[model samples]
Target: MTPPFHSRISGLAARTLQRLRSAVSGRLIDPRNYQPPLPLPGGLSRAQIHDALTAVSIDGSASGELFGYASSDLDRFLYTLAMVPEGAVGKALEIGANPYFNTLLLRQFRPELELTLVNYFGPGSAQGKQTVSFPGFKGVADAVTFQYDNVNIESAALPYPDDSFDYVVFCEVLEHMTHDPLRSMLELKRVLKQGGTMILTTPNAARLENISAFLEGRNMYDPFSAYGPYGRHNREYTRHELHMLMTHCGFEVEASFTGNVHPDIPLGQADASTLNRLIGQVRHREHDLGQYLFTRWANARVASEKLPNWLYRSYPAERMAEGQ
Candidate 1:
């Protein structure tokens, strides 16, 4: 399926911003900064790494219905997931694992992993709307279990007992839980074992494409969908915003960085040294930048004191009832 008008416009907007930066400045640029994350050490070349990351391809599929890590905000996340410190994973819980591309990737890269995939939907369920054509993951892990729970993340009690998982992968699910992100984080924290790892990825509200959207009195979201705002992205975050959310929920962030540029996004030319330098710096850490921000946090051995009143004070029960 073809991508919608908004996605194409957003991609073009992102490209134009980068190109403008490149053209307005004069200096030699390092080409490496514009490339994607470095390939993993598993003997796969860059092209192979990308293909493997996107284990399921939706190339000819229409845009909105397309699934998998290839073209969505999740592309950088799979790359970041591949880079999780080797040997750090044992038992893992994946929230929102409907598509399950990461599970497939980890099966190749970390065959010993045990995964529990928890989602509101999966392969055979009526809610299993995405990736219907891919069949299911094959020859992945020795153990992979699927569980279903459609309760809202903000207030629902996770079915698992406390401290049940060594790692929790919650990628690109946050923006969808706009009304109660803090509560969702707390839920994830409660299920994770002390010192367990939590790998998170979310869109950056300050991405260059968004900045352009704001200046033009437009937002890149699709407003007409059934989920409406939440169906697309109910909310997005900046690097600081995500860090604060994690800290408030008692997870100690270990490392953070940004990447996952749209393939159509432009990298400034080598001749536009000034713009290239700016782009390099922003891409390195922060600024008008990448499509998604990635972070890994360790569930602290000792939980912090309960979050401040302000954290939940704004979350009126009425708003929570609305459920985004």
Candidate 2:
């Protein structure tokens, strides 16, 4: 028998209310559902990798909280590892590696790699040795300790001689630079061997969340951090800007794309669907809307050393003119 007309209307209204609640509350994508974009090296399983990374313990320090934050973002770290080329040998430099999540992964998967780490405490930080320990796994000991150097990449020249490293992993550090990111790029180019690769990753400024925020008339800037100026994201780059920066810095762009390393949050399905449909119409914007941007650049030519005017102002006239 068919329901009465009033009863059917009541059921429809209830269903509509439930959908509204879900749209308002939002949904979180389960981290366990993550799949690697590329095949993982060393024939390791995701479960094994998760166990090893989660097992990491940092000694007592102010950075302990920071280490915890890194632990929570396992997906981000794993994607970084996947982006790194396998069979890479020779010295690798990981800038701003204090939390040491990525450092540990590199040591585990790429045992043949001679890895050196660098961290900056602050402007007053001096170059010195500091050790970190992680639990043992295959091809590693029961406990592993790493000693890294303290150096300021933005102000001082890198302590290493030119062409010192075959691979430079400059992940998540570029956005922390308050000024003169080009200077740091030049320093990296100096340290990287000819034809060597530099893997650079940073948050995409044009990400979906930021777009949502702008549409809603909300501020999109990062909050001031207790960890000081370097603690917050000073600036973020879009995919196009990164390509231009690398080209200007004299690196041959090998491979680059944006991908979401973090789990997804509901952006209001209606709004999200509309945005996605619009983005689908534009071919260039399709790949530009991920949580993070990963790029591989090869040191091919002498750096042009020109700072694009679009990215800088209040500079010496000559420098601006040179970029123009």
- Number of the predicted model whose TM-score against the real structure is largest: 2
lDDT of 1 by residue, 42-97 (tens): 56554554444344533335434333335453446445555456655588877777
Tens digits of lDDT, candidate 2, 144-203 = 556767777888887889999999999999999999899999999999999998989898
Which pairs of residues collide in model 1? Answer: 1-61, 1-62, 1-63, 2-62, 2-63, 26-273, 27-273
What is the TM-score of each predicted model, taking all chains together? 0.68, 0.82
Poorest stretch of ten by lDDT in candidate 2: 1-10
- Highest lDDT, which number? 2
Candidate 2: TM-score?
A: 0.82
Off by over 4 Å in 2: 1-38, 60-68, 138-141, 268-270, 321-324
- Positional deviation of 254 in candidate 2, in angstroms? 1.5
